[model samples]
Target: MAMDRELVTCTKGDGFWTRRILCTIRRLVRLSAKSSTVGNMAVLILSISCIDGNLLNAFYHAAPSSEIIRQSSMNSTISSVIFKDYDVTVMLFHSAYLVDIEQTEKGRVMKLDSLKNGDIWKTMDVLVFNSWLWWYRRGPKQPWDYLQYRSKIVKDMDRMFAYKMALRTWTRWVNSQVNATSTKIFFQGISPSHYNGSEWNEPGVTNCLREEQPVDGSTYPGGKPMAATVLRSALAPVRNKVQLLDITLLSQLRKDAHPSRYNGFKSMDCTHWCVPGLPDIWNQLLFASLFS
Candidate 1:
């Protein structure tokens, strides 16, 4: 079989890169790496990533209107972070939606034409965002059942189109609310899964199970996913304002890195990566971009 969708988990990194990111963060907490502002600089990361063993958003199982903090079931410390030496406050939200929704006669509707959630990204010294992977949702897993676009309520729009509209709303907010002189912005690229072997030129294989080696070269045999193209095109309008951390191509070459069949209990979990592995590289790249 093949992985129809991603299976997000609560796995965490091994702390080598996570700690390194924090160390580097102390140096460049501000947009200009200014010592005066490093101690007080604030960063807001909107992603599905994990830190301290907590998933940022972990949306594949998230209930609708999950923006509300539970305060009981989850630990509060995960939402905000502060290091001993660095006084920066970093807030991580599992937010991919940057628009509003209204309850209409047609059920819940997401207004793709509006950015009602722009306030989430406003006034932060550094904003890092990742909004892919969840775009492929459907059936019980899909968060929104209806999408309101151009004044029309749609039962379902093309995933690519919906993804584009969501990013467009976010990029528009970045262009409008995020000032380049004050805030540094970054957008993570589409994350890839190794469900189908053909994508990496291994036609006989079915998944990442038992794989122990990377694709032998720099170029991924599968070329680029259509989502990657859409991601770049959507960011074109605000590219100057938001830096793109294009991790897809390099990640596509790591079919062997997924936590696929590490044990029989969760063998088919090919969508997410293994902890102490690929996420380190992703965070390394993210830190590099932050310094640049």
Candidate 2:
């Protein structure tokens, strides 16, 4: 039941004014599953990592005629390329958080700063970001050491407060660094998890281990998470600078879409959705937003 292959496709037009259509198809092909043909096309099987690095590589490699002005290591947090033939400058930045946060490593805390400070925002024509999954980790699993506020360290703070502070910092950065007319900014809403089976109305079940179908409804029985509320409130001030892709409610119904036992029976994984599964739906929503 292990995930076998993933496919992602992104295309940029030759016209200067044309909007880029980046379609990421993260398909997890299981070997045992029956093959189905659509029209005259045969489904191609390719293997790659998640959306960030692999997607960029696929986009560049697909265009052999385009001259790559600059190319760097695959491991770098930021990557840029100038396509001479397409007249497009594409840059990708891996900003783990919108604001500065403390990271704990080997009993040492490290401070990470905002995306604007890195000078990457200035070059981006389109920026899409998601920063909810990491915030839920607690204790050793959480990388952050302590929350830093206004040049002072706080031993502990409400998660909502920390999230809002980071989001506001990001908005302030956007206000100073981004031009709303020229740059497109998007914030993906919080992705919901199905760890608690009671959330889906199956009280005895501990997690999404044996779930094979989504909760049948337009809304989740558990409603929304508190973090989603915090996110909406934080984005209020910067609604002009950024667009929120609210995918939470739709994604919440997809309890069967997670990796679950497909990853292995070792532990229940109800967090990350299966590639070519729920994430594809998210990308479609993202694509529609960009074009709209």
Candidate 3:
């Protein structure tokens, strides 16, 4: 069984595939168990298998404050479904940096040049990068003027530009990781928000997420056209090398899949999703894209 797992790890590319194979093996083992004791043994084996798997991957996930702070039902679901027990470190934030790249599966968040001679450029197996929801969450800045305020805390362009530059440098470094085959890169596309109060936009839906779930085919109105355009402008240069997961259109359609309705949150949240729902969808799409 250990040998088979090693082979699966090598051929299937580590974390995700190994977990899948182990899951199958566990179900089979459970079916063959003679008693409750055997079932417990099977469960232990399953846990150990996951712990020992050698799929070291990393996901540098970024999104706007709205997505993280508000906790989108879809986002939560996606994280739970796709990342459960996986050998992936999700550095989830609106922005961050790869300070020292030489730390070997453990790099600090310093300046970009600090990674100039580090080996993080070679050891990474997968790179999942993103940033967009932040801008949307904050709405838009004036053409010649910008404003950033967290209630009473307000920052100017210097801080915002520094944040953007740091993120860009981090992503550029991520793109430099070695072994393209061993490394599968992905980026989340723009997720259109529905705050405009337009007919299709569905105004006044404070926290749309709930457990009851709205229909799946309804779309949030009015954000994506410009949003995607801006996102494309930002990521287009790396598009060829990255698998852009455009989940916006489909996500918007799930009207009730927000924090309040679909997510675990009690209020009508607009950001995160229910773990079993949209996250599963994202993982399905992710797996298919990998194989197909």
Which is the leading candidate under TM-score?
1
Candidate 1 deviation (Cα RMSD): 7.3
Q: Per-candidate RMSD vs. true structure?
A: 7.3, 11.1, 14.9
Off by over 4 Å in 2: 1-75, 79-85, 89-91, 101-118, 139-141, 264-266
lDDT (Cα, 0-100) at 103 in candidate 1: 72
* Predicted structure 3, TM vs. truth: 0.49
Tell me the TM-score of each prediction against the true structure.
Answer: 0.79, 0.72, 0.49
lDDT of 3 by residue, 1-292 (tens): 6544434433332334435433433343344422234332221100001111212111112211122211224433212113233222222221212232122232222343334522532333334444544432332532112232222212334533434544455456656753444445666665544333352544564434332444334554444555555555556666666677778778766655544543234444555543334544554555455443
lDDT of each: 0.65, 0.58, 0.40
Prediction-by-prediction clash tally: 0, 1, 29
Model 1 lDDT tens row, 1-292: 1221232333223244444555555556543544355455555555554321232322112222223232211733236544334444556655555566667676767788787645655666777777777777778866677987787777887878888888787777777777786677887888888878888777887888878899998998888999999989989999788888888988888888877877446558677776546765776787678666
Clashing pairs in 1: none
Q: In candidate 2, list every pair of residues with a backbone clash.
A: 26-276
Question: Cα lDDT of model 1 overall?
Answer: 0.65
Candidate 1 total steric clashes: 0
RMSD of 3: 14.9
